[model samples]
Target: MKLLLDENLSHRLVGLLAAEFPDSAHPRQLGLRGASDQTIWDYAREHGFAIVSKDNDFRQRVFVEGPPPKVIWLSIGNAGTSAIAALLRSHAPEIRAFARSAQEGLLVIEKAPL
Candidate 1:
């Protein structure tokens, strides 16, 4: 499944994770920088992207509105973009499974405690 990196996430992640998540997009690249969450959510639903975000807003929305556009909530606080990329890569299988699941709307990913 493709990912649409949220504003809170570094846009560079799209390129960094491209090998695994092809065609992923970033709000800046889409001219959606500073756009509202509703607008971003609508875009993802129309284009079939799982929203990847460090913020909790999208996670909250997914629970209340369920699928079409799923959410991959990154719970890694104040992390660098590389760390975020590594976390996602390590969880690629689970992320794909979550995207394919018909009933689940949210996937909360956090750094494995050191």
Candidate 2:
């Protein structure tokens, strides 16, 4: 599953979680650092990348429209890289399942432990 990490997330996350998410990329790396939400959404749709973001805007957009590229909305509170990684570790199975299934929607990840 390719993830297009939104600008709200630190670009460092790309390297930190590279092993787990091989095809992942941050907006900065793709020269899309300051792009608008519409641009980001267009890019993800074009490139077949499911967006991973802390922004709630995408969630609303997804509900109104549908998903061409699915979204992993990190609705959790502010956290360090380690905490985010831990969350991903615990939810790896669910993530994989969601990525593979044709069901396109937002995956809201909460702050508390699973």
lDDT of 2 by residue, 55-75 (tens): 888877888778977889887
Clash count, candidate 2: 0
For residue 19, model 1's alpha carbon misses the true position, in angstroms, by: 0.3
- The true-versus-predicted C-alpha distance at residue 26 of model 2, in Å, is 0.5
Off by over 4 Å in 2: none
TM-score of each: 0.97, 0.91
- In model 2, the Cα lDDT at residue 5 comes to 84
Candidate number with greatest lDDT:
1
Best by TM-score: 1
lDDT of 1 by residue, 19-76 (tens): 9999999989999999999999999999999999988899999888988799999989
Q: Which regions of candidate 1 deviate over 4 angstroms?
A: none
